[model samples]
Target: MPHPSCARRWAMPKKAKQADLKKLAICVGLGAAIWAIPAPAGVGLPAWRLLGIFLGTIAGIITQPLPLGAVAMMGLGAAQLTGILTFQAAFSAFANEIPWLIAIAFWLSGGFIRSGLGARIAYSIVSVFGKTTLGLTYSLTLAEALLAPAIPSVAARAGGLFLPLAKALCLACGSDPANGTEGKMGSYLMMTCFLSTTISSAMFITAMAANPLAVNLAAETLGYTISWGTWALSALAPGLVCLLLTPALMYVLYPPQVKDTPDAPAKAKEELKRLGPMSRDEKITAFALGLTVCLWIGGQSLGINAVAAALAGLSILLVTNVVTWEQCLSDNQAWDTLTWFAALIAMAAYLNKYGFISWFSDKVVGMVGGLGLSWQAAFGVVTALYFYSHYFFASGAAHIGAMYTAFVSVSIACGTPGIVAALALGQLSNVMGCLTTYGIGSAPPYYGTGYVPQAKWYQFGFIFSVIYLVVWVGVGSAWWKVLGLY
Candidate 1:
């Protein structure tokens, strides 16, 4: 017989594997069953079939049946084999500029991590503004805002850059996530960083991958062109308000025991000294990052595409050896995100191509029309429903692709102004992401840091969602009136 310890260890993995297989089987079986059920006479086979696959995939993601990329691919493959989607259509998402932009941004972030440039910036800020716990939180918020305009992947920004620094800072302060000492300062910092990045992601068109995707959908659905400046201008007031208020609010709501951090600035300085001067790799990463930011900001005037600009920046990272080819290829998160995002983009595009979105929008318009409410009142109800629905989504891009067009169409049919409805829904795409940890790319990593418990995360998410809705929608509507958007 095997030794008892070895037997227990081996059995544990086997049991877990069995559980995973069972979940996968359940997901696949449910999808097939759904597909087998005939749709109502008016609904097209393609639309109904696609819905089945999409639901199954989402369930699989939530249920942990398989890796997200694997589940996404399985959905695509099922659609192709069932004749719901053509082979060419299934592969088209890989060609999408938005997903590739995200991938390139991920690669660039690797350069920042490997070269220590991201850490250097974080420490520098903390040293300057670490006199109090609230000051440190503000520094993190400021850092995230400064970097938001240039970095399209909030995962890379929050997960890759800010997370490491936040962890290090927590450790330096003698607060550990794993040892139940998180309430000292780690939880507060983690929550502050998470919320700050979420708000910052709305401040610029290029701040997060989902922003560009939202812009594309708006242009396609409404024939409204939203420039980078236009997106930034619209979000400036509301985004800054949320960003400024978040840290202070967290300070009041979840005050850390370690309110005094006077030694933190000195500690940061000492830590910087220990690391000595910046290296060649750091310099290269810094130069590439700066050049890329300038290019992205001015790309419209230069007639350069954002995706192409990111690719160019990636090439610079490669040539300078700030990040090795092996490192880039080995980044599982980047590749995994690319696969799932591409597959989702393809599926969403086909939904629009096949008239599903139009049908859905028509139904919604009918429902709202029957209510006899005025346009503003109707829009308020529609916006509330749309914003809260984010709790079901794991990706902001997916939410925007699925619901944004339909909601905007309904709002317009209800007599709301086109520009007002378009921009409101567009900005809320990022704002709703605050509703849950899985609501956006950056949320998962921040949650995975182990500082905040899941229940508290959810509780706090609800609290803050109400706060942001008031600020962004209430205050934002008034600001839009001033800008003559209505």
Candidate 2:
């Protein structure tokens, strides 16, 4: 007979399989229920059917009955097999530039980790400003902000890069979660770093994978084109303010027992000394990153597409062997993102193409118009609803794919300025991740550290969600006014 522990391990997979099957049943049931509804007067049957598939796919993504890519493939197949879309129409978005841009950027982002540049930068900042607990948290925040544009994956940036660093700092300070000493410094740092990732994600177009999806949706839905420079400039002031305030705010809300960490700087320096001089790969990665960023910011004026710029950057990395071709092929995240992103984009575009979005916008406008509120107030209501709805979403990409275009459409239909509506909703697509531990990609690792209890995590998440909205909407609007974005 097997040992008890071995038997328990064998039983675990069966239990997980049952759970997944239940979730999958929910997704299929939801889709079937929606499909049973008659198509609205102005919408085609195909459009309504695609909506069912799209929504079911979103539910699958959130609940994760299968891998994200598998969920997406199933949704796409459902649409095609049900005669809701042709094979060509189902896969056409794969040809779009947005998905390719994100995929290529993901490959480029890997160089930061592979070259040890990401760690080097984090340690260097810690060595400079890590004398106190607050300062140490700020250093991590700064590192995240600096790295966000280059590293598109928040999981990689936060979990792979900063999570380990934060844990190390905590260990160095004798604050192990295992020892009930997480309050010494671990909890505060973990919360701050996790929140900071969301803020930095809002700052740049390339900072998060879903950001480009939002950009694409805005262009398709609102006919508003937000360039890389526009996104960066619009977010610069508000993003910085959020980053600056987050560490301090967390320090106040979740004070560390260890207020002074005098040894942190020494530890960081020792880490730096161990890393020694920058390797050739690091220099190449740095050069490629700098060039890509400059091009992204100003390449439009030079008549270069942002996707072209990213492709160029990835080419440089491959040529220099900063990241090998084999490594790029092995980048499961990039390929997975490409697959799901393309499918969702195709589905969303077809929704608009078939006139469902316009029909839905009309229905929304009629309801909101009945309230006799001013356009500004209507938009505020819409924006608030959009931001808070993130609580129901696990992946930022799923949230963006499912709701961004519709919300932007409703906002514009309510007479909000198109650019203002698009940018506001776009920025919130990222910042909304601050509302829950499972709100986005980077949340799990930080929360899994056991530093902050689930209750405290949710509590701080709510507090910061409000704080983020005020900063991004209030301060961000003022900055946008100066830039004439409105």
Candidate 3:
């Protein structure tokens, strides 16, 4: 590893660094040129100016012209320099509870990873369920669901735990990627690993970094507040069905060549023995996580916000030394997410404040109205299109930033109930990740194993995306209806 002092200098080859700078300059130059065009009829100059910065920021994110946060910071700075937003307004993004909740959850999960609690839990489940090829698939899925709530970073949970275990399981079964034997069982498990995490991410507001961002956006758009309990309760029925059926569906769709793995349980047990007993730090992390869940679920009645519960839990971990201060600070992903999320949140807020979102919504609603479809039909078409549009996006949060508000606004204007519209759109923001190998946080790690080729991954992605949408849309719609969300 390079020294800390020179880490950024040596982070990439010089050629790649220059290429990224070129991409950044092109995005900014094009965005500024676009902003120079005169606004039509009623759109104000500030809204148009802010829109320019927003477009440029999104370009940087998609092209990865810089680290995501750095790109976002440049947008924030641009907004201030152009006088589109005051200093207080731009910095106000950090004051929002949504980003803080996400950041703190990341810190709390660091304790689980650092203390080895998450790995212990995964191995424990594996020992029970690894007796059969089918059982081992379910074991990995269940392990991810258990960890998703506390661990906001799905990439860490899936990559850190599922990736290594999956490789081991596949190799143990003689399904080596290098030998072209991934068709045996490796492909099935790897596909299930990613699909399961996507479902779990939709099931809880704290399950992924983008979920809380969805909640905040829903609030900004429709005055809806999605708490941890509300998000879980809404997703409980369909989410459980999707989780239960995904492994079986993949088993049939992508059948494993090696089926009779009767010795797998013994292998898992042996691995567990090697890990030994859970350490004190592991115990403490588990306890803190459990407590945090309880507080997140119940604290609303006691006048506590979920953000506070997360902070309180993180404090316990810090004080108990379950995770060191340096470990928490060194969580670069969490901090990076915080910066970009804040910047996006600020832009979203200013867009609403400047009437850009509302103005754009009215114009879109008028065109949809011109189609002469009933409100129900219009919304159904829009929602389907929005969910499948993930094929064009590589990040869930960025997709949310670009399309969520306008879609929700259109849905509401088309006479869809606010609560129903908000929850469905919010949930789909995560479920849509099933459409691509690079669509969400956990996608790359699972895809990087090379067990599933690009063509096969996309094929499976389309097939599974349909299954997930049916469960989430059909079954989920019924569940929400029963809850009177509509």
Candidate 4:
């Protein structure tokens, strides 16, 4: 080790400069200072500080200067307490549909995971395509993608299924969990699986409970007609493509390469052998899920809505003992996540109700209208609106609840196509996940697991956000136009 002075002179910029520590500290310090204020008014230095905090946060999120979730919650609490927003308004986020959907679905997914049912399902997927690493990765992704459009819970698919199986595979491959490639792979794959599931959750109406409301609002407010299959079809390309690439991307992101081990230990082999068959719970859960899909699609085609379809499946499960109320209630992360989601949705809706969003949006639109670049000006509004969304919402549904109608209505007034707006809004729901780890539509269970460090998670978020923004604005624009959505 070098002397303190010499080290200070030579050490940091190369190896120690991995993160913008000073910036993070400044933001955190200032954010905490604002948080300490009794009144969060936007009028004086406090107001200016609050504004700086807000702009700084957005800038940081765009630049990934820190953790998004921590920052979001801090902002939430501060804005409310400081009088910038009402407590009722701040707390109102808990009542939102998106949060409710996200939280409740986790319980639904948890029951499946806790009951050993999720494993049997994974084993089946692996049985079909677990020979090669790529095959296994794709197989897991396919299971997620296929179910993503219908299942409200992603944790069950990622944490419950993928993580466990990946771990088992690592163990089987002689990879030590104590440290190194195996552990990294497990962590990385788990993150990938979680992120993919969150993004994919935007693919269908039933994929998340908030979706129906989003669709309904768009329909009611903007006369947009978003059929279930049509919505899925619109999102499947981008969402699925993302899911397919995620495993490989994460593999690189984490960079873990350990070959499979020879075989299982004799004792472990015996245990595996004795693991003889899928548990009864597994059998029923699998059957129930399959039936749920059929009924969900067929029932909806028969004119049933996603909620009705979900309730129908849920009811049937409760009646059949597939998932009991006790089990559902016991799954803390599941329901908590949903409640959190609901709060977000409610808050967004409340913002609109209070004229907060409309006032802000009107001013923004007014400012852009003067530029006179018509389409480009319009794009600026869309992009700004999308960025603002993460500040308030934690998921796609929440974003939809907050701004779907407002954005669409304003777009139409500006001569943007309704179809274009719908697709843009839908895709924005998935894309926002990149802004922050917590901003992920389906992230609670993943985040709650304590694997992805809050800061690194935010880092991943910003990087992914750039990818999403470019993809949607640059590539998606042309695709939507060519597809006649414009």
Candidate maximizing lDDT: 2
Model 1: CA > 4 A from native: 1-19, 131-134, 146-198, 201-237, 248-260, 388-419, 435-466, 478-486
lDDT (Cα, tens digit) per residue for candidate 2, span 126-232: 67877888988887789778988876666555654566567656655566665678899889988999999999998888888789999998999866678999889
Prediction 3 TM-score vs. true: 0.66
Measured on C-alpha atoms, candidate 4 has an lDDT of 0.55
lDDT string for model 3 (1-486, tens) is 101211111122222233387889988986797699987667888988887888788677657678767888998999899899898988887986656665665666556555666555645555677667898888778878987886665665565445655655565456766567888888998998888989888888878778788889889987657778888999899889989999998999888887766776686677667768877887887788777767665676788766777777788898997766776666565677778767776776677677665676556666775776887788777788778766545467767776787888888877888777778888878878777655776776566556877667778888987888788778988898899887
Predicted model with the maximum TM-score = 1
- In TM-score terms, candidate 4 sits at 0.66
True-structure RMSD, every candidate: 6.8, 8.0, 7.5, 10.0
The models' CA-based lDDT, in order, is 0.74, 0.76, 0.73, 0.55
Cα lDDT tens digits for candidate 1, 4-49:
1211211222212234888888888888887899975667889878
The local distance difference test score of model 2 is 0.76
Residue pairs in candidate 1 whose N, alpha carbon or C atoms collide under 3 angstroms: none
Please write out the lDDT profile of model 4 over residues 1-486, one tens digit for every residue.
111121111112212224567766776666566546663322344344444445445444434353444444555565666675567766676644345444444444544554455444444444545444556666666777776655554433444334445434433343432334334344565566666665666667766556677778878866656888777666655665666667777666654453232232343344445556777665665565555456544665586643454455456567777667876665544554454444444444444555455455555566655566676468656665666457655556556766677667666667777766776676566657655544654565556444465566676666666665666566666766666676
Stretches > 4 Å off in candidate 2:
1-19, 131-241, 245-261, 374-379, 385-467, 470-486
| Stronger candidate by lDDT (2 vs 4) | 2
Q: Please state the error at residue 414 of candidate 4 in Å.
A: 4.8
